[model samples]
Target: MSKSKRLMELMMTVNRMRKFTVRQLADQFDVSPRTILRDLQELSELGVPLYSEVGPHGGYQVLKERILPPIAFSEEEAVAMFFASHALRHYLFLPFEAESSTALQKFYYYMPGDVRDRIDQMKNRVDFLTHTRQQKAEYLGVLLEASVDQRVVTMQYETKNGYSERTIQPVGIYASNGFWYCPAYCFLRRDFRLFRCDRMQSVANDSTGIEPLDHRHIHLGNWEEHGSEKPVYIRMIVDLSREGVRRCESELWHVPHMDITPDGSGQLNQNVPSSELMYFAKFFIGLGNEATVKEPSELVECMKGILNEIMAKYD
Candidate 1:
């Protein structure tokens, strides 16, 4: 095999075995012990973090490091990451665009010549669907940095009513529906909240030495789970005749609890906040009478109001 391919195989061996003696690696790669040691030294210089121990059981191992040297990607792998990153550039908006671009540049630069050429050709041939214009901002990165550093920040937030200043202890950054959101504990509100990064006007580090809040209350995966004092039970009845029973059985909507009555009536039970319950109600609006909110009089009223609004639009 060529030296590059041999080196790639050696790296894979080192990663998989965790520790391998020079003799063992030499035997596996069908090379001399001297050559194996040389290869390990080369990888170490390239930032592979391969370390050797001396004794009877001594072998080489890779030390865990936060930042390691880049790995060799096949032509297909390079193109896949490039396309994925390219698609993310549109949705991530501000800070991620520059960051992903820089990372992609580094990836391209380090790729083998043939793979790099193939990626460049693919990039020239592929075109992404252009997105609508968006307001440019940089606070996403700032919030991300603060979250990673576990630092407190004071920022001006724009809410539906108006702008308000807040002191927040940021816990994590998340993305939902093509927008960036920071889940943090707001000192002003004295509760955990999700804030849209695009709506933030200004952010500055506050060195007031505020303790990091417990993140147990933060459910970064689902925003609906946060900001609720009482869990509201929402039940829905879906007609299998109009809506395919197969789709409901597929669990597309992520309903946690559900039941089917003997008479073929489907019941969905979920403990969600009022806002999330209403948000989900809109999804069944076009189903007409085929979908119905069965419980929580408030949700039934909300769905009725939505149906009324739709009727008004038609009128």
Candidate 2:
């Protein structure tokens, strides 16, 4: 590595560990103590805020709260960061757009010449889909903060049936289909619920005096898939046609056991609790009439109701 690069790496090591003697640094970098001291002096002169302490435990340390200069990135590193930021820019609809653009510009400007040349050569070959429009950025920011802080929020949510005011403690934010969703514990229903971020008419941080629930008590993903209800096994018979086999193999649905006969006819046996049966039903709706629930009277009724609704639409 170049002297500047080696010095930058040493600076990072020292910053993370909080203290390192010149001898220790020399050993780490495989250099002489004199070279380590010279590098430290150069770094200090470059506004790195490195200080040396004297005594039994004395070593060089970057003072806390000091902002270090940006490290140089290789051409590959620059391109990778750019691509990551580009992907986020497309998927994330938030106030981060300007920040992402500025960071990308600064990265490209500081990158070494050879690295920059490689990035330029590959730039045209890398492109992402741009058809999707940007979403409200502030909503995402608020949802993220709520999830991290474990704070409750009050929002007016628009469901397919109608609108309702709700107070919920957000557990996490996830993307499904093309929209963002906040899975939270709803106060009104006294259960976990998923709220579409965009469909939220109004959202505000709630500071009212209510004891925050312990997040560890809830299974957020399972709650989102199947409410707080206990799971019950539901059996499904999936046809083993080419399309059916491929569909069952998809990660989107969880099928525990599937048996295929010599004739290509297959039985897909899934042990889904009542909690996730609705999700399974919604997923299988795309299979037309080929996917059938053979057992669990409740699930059969649910599927029949859904099919009835679809048939009604045609009638």
Local distance difference test scores for all models: 0.70, 0.71
- In candidate 2 the C-alpha lDDT for residue 65 amounts to 52
Candidate 2 local lDDT, 38-63, one digit each (tens): 88888777767877799998887888
Which candidate number would show the highest lDDT if scored against the true structure? Answer: 2
lDDT of 1 by residue, 196-293 (tens): 88888999998677776655444456544565544555444444432533334442435435566665556565556665756756755645555555
Q: How accurate is candidate 2 locally (lDDT)?
A: 0.71
List runs of model 2 lying over 4 Å from the truth. Answer: 1-78, 92-98, 113-137, 216-228, 237-269, 273-282, 285-315
Candidate 2 Cα deviation (angstroms), residue 92: 5.3
lDDT of 2 at 277: 64
Off by over 4 Å in 1: 1-67, 92-95, 109-137, 207-209, 214-230, 237-269, 286-298, 310-315
Per-candidate TM-score against the hidden true structure: 0.60, 0.59
Candidate 1 displacement at residue 20 in angstroms: 27
* Candidate 1 CA-lDDT value: 0.70
